[model samples]
Target: MRNTFLKASFMAAMASIGAGEAGAADYRKNPFTLAYDGAITQNEPGKVNIHPVTYKLNGLDIAANVYIPANYDPKQAYPTVVVAHPNGGVKEQVAGLYAQRLAEQGYITITADAAYQGASAGQPRSTDKPAYRIEDIHGMADFISQYAGVDRKRLGLLGICGGGGYSLAAAQTDKRFKSVATISMFNSGRVRRNGYNDSQLNSVQQRLQQASEARAQEAAGAAVLYSGDANLSDEQIAKLPFELYRQGYEYYWKTHAHPNSTFKYTTSSLLDLMRFDATDQIALIGQPLLMIAGSEADSLYMTEDAFAKASGAHDKELFIIEGATHIETYWVPKYVDAAIGKLSAFYGKTL
Candidate 1:
């Protein structure tokens, strides 16, 4: 049972952003182009509004959405949150959902595609490196902080799934973030290096060697290689062993998929990923922290371990949503509400 659970999580992490071709019809159902349920169709003067924006990060144009509260006034200062998306995720998905919800609660929020993923520009696309992901969080902070009516001292962060892991790394040294939080936190480096729950521990060196070879091939003018890219049929997906895997496929490839989202990453990226650990130097984050996870989430262990090692966060707390799984926390209304409610209180007290 334990091995099955671990294997399911490992495979789920690998395929969380399953591959699919988006057509004109998949451009999104709403004017804002957000793929999540209850996404705002049109901005209203007295309601939460989403602004599409682009900014340069490391010379690459980063696509992002900024959500401002209802009756927003430039003259009135407001606390702000920067949300980081999950692995193979784009700003248009769950990250945007949480950002918009938080905005509706009177906070300014922003969710951007990580460099080289989603609508963001980068060559040899879908490059998933730890440094780039961490910097993306910082870059969002830079842009959002300068926006009108932002209170620099009250800036907060919310990282979802893989973004949660990278955000922990970013907050370690980026003191600019006044408060930090993670929902359904996934430690990407740990999963990539050790496999989910360390089920692939014995093959770590072998995988590293493969990544090194892939990097060499890329340097020698070979075609870029990808990993975790799959176009599974419904029957194939149904036979998957775990709830996380089955539900994740439905979420990313079926119900809430967006064109910019893809499950693959440069195989060479494993070189950097294997060496990265989100919990490394985690104690450097001395700011107040809030870590939320679903009680039934197969990925809950990651959150638990990280929260335990957050020795530097003197005011950290872990809130769990009962009966919620890893992916459920992303879009299930009641679960999302539970998370947002806790986030509201956490940011309210800390920020």
Candidate 2:
């Protein structure tokens, strides 16, 4: 049995974040348990339909949703896109929103919960490593390319936030994604190694030491340590320094909260995160690339940095949504429309 004290502490921590009772309620009432606005309540003939799926990736079961366009005919090939979710985000959030939107545009799309996060299976839950995240993208491609009505040769990829960064790394050599796109790209490695916007650059070594200690503790069969877990009041959330985080809290905890989504990851995973940079092999991506960011987002620098380094990407473009911030791009109606417009055009031309 797991250590009682550690298990209790973990449960307490989770409780402080948000309640999963609502999610349970959703599942019992709505078969799909979808929480987004305009989500399909039921699959009607000749209309967009969502299929909940589970597949094996490595040895883990990946929970995912596959969206097929209206009047679907499996015999005919359709361009497909593998949409990757943001860090701490689940398939029911922005990823599912985008997948559904893409499906409405007459393309097949899929979004999955990364292994070790959301509803996926893994030990030491929330153990987020770049390799695993990148592999998740590859795993999505492997499954979706072979999906009915999908054109393997015309497959594309869209990574949101942290998923954007991982998508960059995955497409560096995957070659399967003919076109790549990122919305509000976040460089997880840079942020973890340094700090948000290099704010804690001076404490890099100290954080590394802490991460080492966490790993050591885990190796010794001690309790797991997590990072980025927080419980703050509404006023406290408002006082958060960056617009990205302030709005992120609202998006994740208040407006669009979900049972499985969280902001925490294994603290020991920093050992891998500190050394992994999304732009390391970016020049190897010869496919078309489209990176989108909000004009007013403090996290826009990350997208700019990665886009600049994608030297080998053909038809590369950095499109910015006017007057929008990082989190705003996730769900705000106008911003979402802007992003979808750009994505549709890009995928239509490339795929």
Q: Count the backbone clashes (under 3 Å) in each candidate.
A: 1, 0
lDDT of 1 by residue, 1-351 (tens): 323433553355335444354322243457776888888889888999999999999898888999999999999999999999999888888999999999988999999999888777787778999999999999999999999989999999999999999999999999888899999999988999998767899999999999999999999999999998888889999997767778888888877876667788999999999999989999999999999999999999999999999999999999999999999999899999999999999999888
Cα displacement (Å) at residue 266, model 2: 0.4
- Top candidate on TM-score is 2
Question: What's the lDDT for residue 119 in model 2?
Answer: 76
What stretches of model 2 exceed 4 Å from their correct place? Answer: 1-30
Q: Residue 148 lDDT in model 1?
A: 99
* Model 2: lDDT to the true structure: 0.90
Per-residue lDDT of 113 in model 2: 93
Lowest summed-lDDT stretch of 10 residues in model 2? 21-30
Per-model C-alpha lDDT, please?
A: 0.88, 0.90
Query: Which segments of candidate 1 are over 4 A away from where they belong?
Result: 1-27
